[model samples]
Target: MKPIPLQRRPRGKKPLWREYAEALAVALVLALVIRTFVVQAFKIPSESMLETLLVGDHLLASKFAYGIKLPFTDTYLYKGDEPARGDIIIFRYPNDPSVDYIKRIIGVPGDVIEVRDKQLYRNGQPVRESYIRHTDPTGREPLRDNYAPVTVPPGKYFVMGDNRDNSLDSRFWGFVDKSAIKAKAWRIYWSWGGLDDIRWSRIGKKLL
Candidate 1:
């Protein structure tokens, strides 16, 4: 007598809800990874940065530009190059770690910086900042216009907003620790004016 062939069992399909849930979980993980180590989005909420980063502008920052910091901690897993002068960076406010601030790197570690008559001097040489804007051209405050020279401490940076006349920056708050820095501003992804006025021209513009 011939031997009977054995039948194979068909695989069962996953439930629709389960499939959707799996997809959603995957998406969330990917987003978290990107935000933590690759890049992240931020909105400009103040006019301190002005022409360089206008209020209501949505931008992307490169988290890996300087290094990869461990999530929920200031420790870095992979160290990168130090932030260079002129780099626009997002960092934790020194006074309040819960708040984030964006500013341009004016002085890196060990650089001598000063503000004389509202002009920035680095290492005793005048810095010509074409992007610098003054909302009140004639207005002058003692510390705002004439800050005494100071050396940026090791593992720290001196930062200032592009809107020199109105910004409260390193001249007021002191240096930003390297561990507080999060990312470098990469590009403007979106922007809007008062109410419904969308700034179409600023979208996709690269931040200097």
Candidate 2:
């Protein structure tokens, strides 16, 4: 008797749409991961950082510069370097956590900060700030020009904008808690002034 022929099963394949969907899902997850733990992008909404950062400037911020925090929480997974003086950072607004703000760290914990006649002083000595600009250098506003010395409390930081005269910063609000800080400004990736204007010089510029 002739031997019976064996039956063969065909290999299964995923639908084209399913393969595309899977690829897209992976891409989105990677983007979210990078945004949460590596870096993020921001745009300059105002002239608060003038000359230093202009309106419409798009920049990248290093989220891991401070620490790797758990998603949607203040708890850190891996603690990183602390914010130092002169470091520009993005943080949640103290008065309104729903809002985000950007400013430079002027004083760290236990630091005494003051301003006299438009001059910034830290620890009773004049702090050199070549990047700061004074739109109203002669303005006599007490808070803007002659602020009384105050110590930055522990786990808090005193921050200010590069545009000394026009910015509403720590002098107007209060200290930024360490937990509220989000990321450090890294570099400018793109800049647009208007429909027909692009700030070519600002592109690729590093944030000091």
Candidate 3:
């Protein structure tokens, strides 16, 4: 015999607050997953990478670009990729992991990076930074007040801001350990304020 269908209990009226809370919880979890191993959003806070990355510009950083690290932990969750030269990246400040900073990776593991009069030399050759909008044609100038030649330790990187004149980066703090890297900035998805007004042809374009 065919089983009789169970009688349905009278449907209870659900409070809208419960639905809202459930939705919010799901959103938070999704955000955490994305930030942990997919893509993350970051805002440029300074002009250090100007002409390349500007303040108030919103960019998407990919977790898979380098690899995934355990969220809120130092453990390595995965090592799926490696960073390439000229990549704009976001990382926890070496001095303070609580604070995140963005810059371009200039020197990779084992690279001997030095600055000679604002010119970047990697392994005894001048790095070609044609991406720069302008530099003095007469001669190279010191990008920062301080000067030092840093030998990138194995498994570490030397990062600098594109706006050499304005950023407080490796020159000030020190090299960024590979573990400190968070993501590779790949695209400019959004912008805000006055920066939005100066719409260059490259705005909203992929990071080169």
Candidate 3 per-residue lDDT, tens place, 107-201, comes to: 99888888777777888898899665333344544545325677899888888887776677887788898878888888988776584375555
In the order shown, the candidates' Cα RMSDs to the true structure are 1.5, 1.9, 3.4
TM-score of 3: 0.81
Tens-digit lDDT track of model 1 for 40-128: 99999999998888889999999999989777777879888779999999999999999999999999988999988888999999999
Given candidate 2, what's the lDDT at residue 183?
Answer: 96
Q: Once model 3 is optimally superposed onto the true structure by TM-score, how far is the C-alpha of residue 92 displaced, in angstroms?
A: 1.7
Lowest summed lDDT across 10 adjacent residues in model 3 is found at 133-142
Estimate candidate 1's RMSD in Å. 1.5
Report the number of the highest-lDDT candidate: 2
lDDT of 2 by residue, 134-207 (tens): 88966799788889999999999999999999899999888999999999999999999898998888899999
As for lDDT, the candidate ahead, 1 or 3, is 1
TM-score of each: 0.94, 0.94, 0.81
Clash pairs, candidate 2, are none
List where candidate 3 sits over 4 angstroms from the true fold.
1-13, 72-75, 133-148, 195-203
Model 1 stretches astray by more than 4 angstroms: 72-77
